[model samples]
Target chain A: MSGFIICFLIGLGGSLVYLLRRKKSVKEISLFVTFSLLGFIVWLSIFLGYKVSPDRFFGWIIDSIGL
Target chain B: MENARISGWQFFLLSLNFIVGTAFFVRPGSIIAVSKQDGWIVPLIAGIFAVLIACLWLTLASRNPGLSIVQICTKVAGKYFGGFIALLYIWFFIQLAGWVTRNLGDFMKTILMPRTPISVFHLMFLIVVCYAVIKGVETIARTIEFLAPLVVLIVVVIYLFTLSEWKWERFEPMFQVSTWQLIKDSLPVIGFPYMEAVTLMMLVPYVKSRVKTGLLLGITVATLLISGIVFVTIGVLGVTRTSHFAYPLYIIVQELQIAEFIEHVESTIVIVWLIWIFIKLCISYHCAVTGICQLFRVSDRTWIAIPLVLFISGIAILTHENIVDNIAVDTRYIFQYTSLYGIVLPVLLLFLTWIRRFRKGESGGSA
Candidate 1:
């Protein structure tokens, strides 16, 4: 959660700066920030939380596919 | 951002260097672990398949000349949808950069500096790569062109020294793994260092001439060269021994003894492999920075490169608990991401372009 907040703040701050500059596709900066924050959240959950296992990730996929 | 353009050969060497990067350091052991004696064939098939996929990427680039893949995506799809796709690719490039950096740092820690922290190596590496990315892709390409021959020469010399030690009996008990198993083993080879050439889509537009054929030939030659390296690893170490070691290529290099006088040449080989890894990391960093710059309509990436490097370095350090988990994730899960970017996205882009009837313009089309 700390990782997610830090990354989210970073992304939000960066995108806000760009928004102030009124760059082309200024609206897209929000999208970029959202995605960046989401990516950080996922990485944190996997690497920091140790919640996801590679083997289990694949196994679940295989099971779903009935492979 | 920079308007620098490279010739076909330099571009070929750059692509070659990228394709044969840190992959050769570790892929052999994983493949051998799966296919046993038939590990040699995995690279052969993967290399050939990579050629076909690269040809697709080149065609897409040629059709939409002077535009990076991100730009091409925006042109083909609308701004919103295309920008979303481009952002995904940006993440892929950044993630790949992190992985390669971690691989290099881990390797140096294992072989050379057991006491030194891995973060020190990662920091040193990113500092150099940050300079390369800022100096622009042309500088990196020239370096690769100069270093490519030396890399090939060292590989050849190592292989020659180890040739006499190969035992034919090692190849016996072949075909032990089923065809399905062989196919499974080959997926990493295809999905990684090979199909990962799709990252070249970010580069193809910058080549001055012969974009399609040059990239195709480059990938083909690099793939073949890597296939030979895999074969040599299997021949010298055989399947079981190769699978046992983490750095199989380094072990193969350790076998080199010229008249028992010139020893410890494995250090030299490791240095050369580090150069290869450096070039790969630089290219990935360049892609990520350039993609971000393009995405935000930023005129220059100069300001953001350092922060981006820090972010990636953090990810590299924090992502894996250890090399064992790293390798497990790399071998098993990397295909899911690579297939999406390498195979699915490009095919979708090509299909969309055909449907929309987009054609290359007079000024920007291939020369």
Candidate 2:
């Protein structure tokens, strides 16, 4: 778990630094950070045992519709 | 955005590799399970259906030259509604990328390297895919153009090497399955690799010319090849075993013992499959990234690519509990879900575009 977090931070940080160095536009930077943070939250939830299966979610929706 | 262009031939190869991608390994078993000895015939029917679907997509693309499906959505539907439609497509593409990535991870874990965590495979493969996508479509096209022939040659050679095991009797119960049952079983096949080829609409504008011919021929050839592979697998492994194994093609290759020394060649063939999967992932990932850029009017695709890699990988891991769960969801829901994008959206856009064009024509005549 610790290893995953460290790797995630390094990857996220490194990418941010690279984008900043390139002087990307504000919108581009925000999009990157937004998606990256979303990814982090997802992975953290999965690792912390708050598993959310897309299959089940979709299946539930599909079932409700009676397909 | 970079004014990238791929030649007609390159587009053809890209289309072939993309459709054949993961389906090459995983689809046959499920297909055989449903259709039994008649499994080989499913791809033929599915191929014809796919060509018709491709026609819808091509006509849509032709109407709006040089515009991708995303741009076309916004153009035809107006801003807010079209933007919503485009957003749905972006989500679809990302979800597709996640599924493809998960397919790779699952295959690696189950067959090749059992000890390695599946996430490692997803991360590593997505990282490489991200790099290729960041390079733009032309690089990907050229790369697949070079690799496509090798994949074809290896697959054909594997087919030939297994010929000694072919049994004529395996096909004896041919055509016993009812037409309704056959069609029923074929829905998933159509929805998959065939209908899923709608993603190629994103690449249609990038092809230099003969987009229709290239797209159709690529799909036709892929269909025949998939049919042929299923045919050969049924012949070698027989209907019973073929339907049973998760990776029947791999099993057939593993059983090959040429001259008692030329054996266990599954590993080498896996390298070829990896190429197929890589090309497929690159195209989907590219389409997803490109869709986001065009939809949001973002300046740079490069920055978006890296972050998406993280999000897609998360979805890959979070999508299913395991292979069984994955297969269950696929058989049950994939057709209905994919049809919304593959069938419903393209048809809807095409209808609206025609209506708009007709109104313009009427106004011009009145003037």
Candidate 3:
């Protein structure tokens, strides 16, 4: 769980950096950061496996995506 | 303002480092997997592919002596259209930097600090690379030139250390793999590490001399470096036993047991490999940011380095945590564009320039 939290916050921090730093338009930046973060989430979720509660739900979404 | 000279040996050595760093670390054993005893042929074939692309790069450089790739596109394609191509390339270079950056951090996790968060490693790498980029391309090139000789020296030492166990028979039956299988296996070999030399085209305009630079050095130097790399893995582990390890080269170094005391030499290999990977990533990252800044007509690329570094750090984090297939991406997307930019696109531009010149001659003659 701690590993999971750490990965998530690091990821969130990156997206925040993207939002705050780049000069691209908001819509353009939104697409970039969201896709980027979402992809990370998918990889992390699959890596951790379908554990209890919401962890299992995220894992299910990742499995459905089929890499 | 660019008057420094990187020796022929330095260029040769950089080619060696650039080509051998990642693939030789990963691919040699796979070649062994395919050809079994004939894996020796893969580097030769891959070397030829790299040379051909480099020939095109030189041709393009010669056409526009003082112009960078972005400048060439603008001159050849007209303003807006060329800007788009340059933009795509900037994105490509950025993505390439991101990929290699992530891989370097992964290496740290695998070999050194297994428990350290990957994000921190990436952040440090990005920061260091940004400092180099801000210092400018000439500095980076000179630094690489200086580092290149050291890499060659260490590689020589590694080869020497692995000498007691080499097997001559492992490289026989060189064409044993089916042609299709050989070519398919060779894709990652050509495209990933070697093809990235297309990025060097961006540096050519700044070179102090192009007269002595030849395709042989480009082709054969990296050829020897990669062969040294491949053969080191094979010589240390024997070809048959190396296929299963992901970082076979690292494993090969770990096997160096000397006089019962110098048993663990992996640290030496680790340091050398880290410098090699850092230079490779820094080269790609600088090209990407410089390309963007150049396209926007910025007066200096220095100001852009900080945010660009931050962006690449984010990008490294975003790449799939399990990015083992990065080799495949290199085979597919990177190879295609590199071949296009380094070989096909440049050839097309040169041909167009020639044709236009010929037509003008004819018209001028008629008049």
Best by lDDT: 2
Enumerate clash totals for all models, in the order shown: 0, 0, 0
Candidate 2: misplaced stretches above 4 Å? A1-14, B365-367
Docking class of 2: medium
- For all predictions in the order shown, the interface RMSD in Å is 5.7, 1.0, 11.2
**Which candidate's TM-score is highest?**
2
lDDT of 1 by residue, B1-367 (tens): 6688988888878787888897788788888787778887788778777887887887787677789898888889879999999988898888788878888888889878899988788878898898888888899898888888888888888878888778878888877777777777878888788777777778876788877777777778777777777778877888878888889888877867788787668987987888899889989999888888777777655555655655676667765767788777777667765888898999888888876673444334654
CAPRI-style docking class of model 3 based on DockQ: incorrect
Best by DockQ: 2
TM-score of 2: 0.96
Q: How much of the true contact map at the interface does candidate 3 reproduce, as a fraction?
A: 0.00
Whole-structure CA lDDT of model 1: 0.77
Chain B TM-score in candidate 3, rounded to 2 decimals? Answer: 0.89
After superposition, candidate 1 runs with Cα above 4 Å error:
A1-67, B175-180, B358-367
RMSD of 1: 5.4
TM-scores for candidates 1 onward, in order: 0.84, 0.96, 0.78
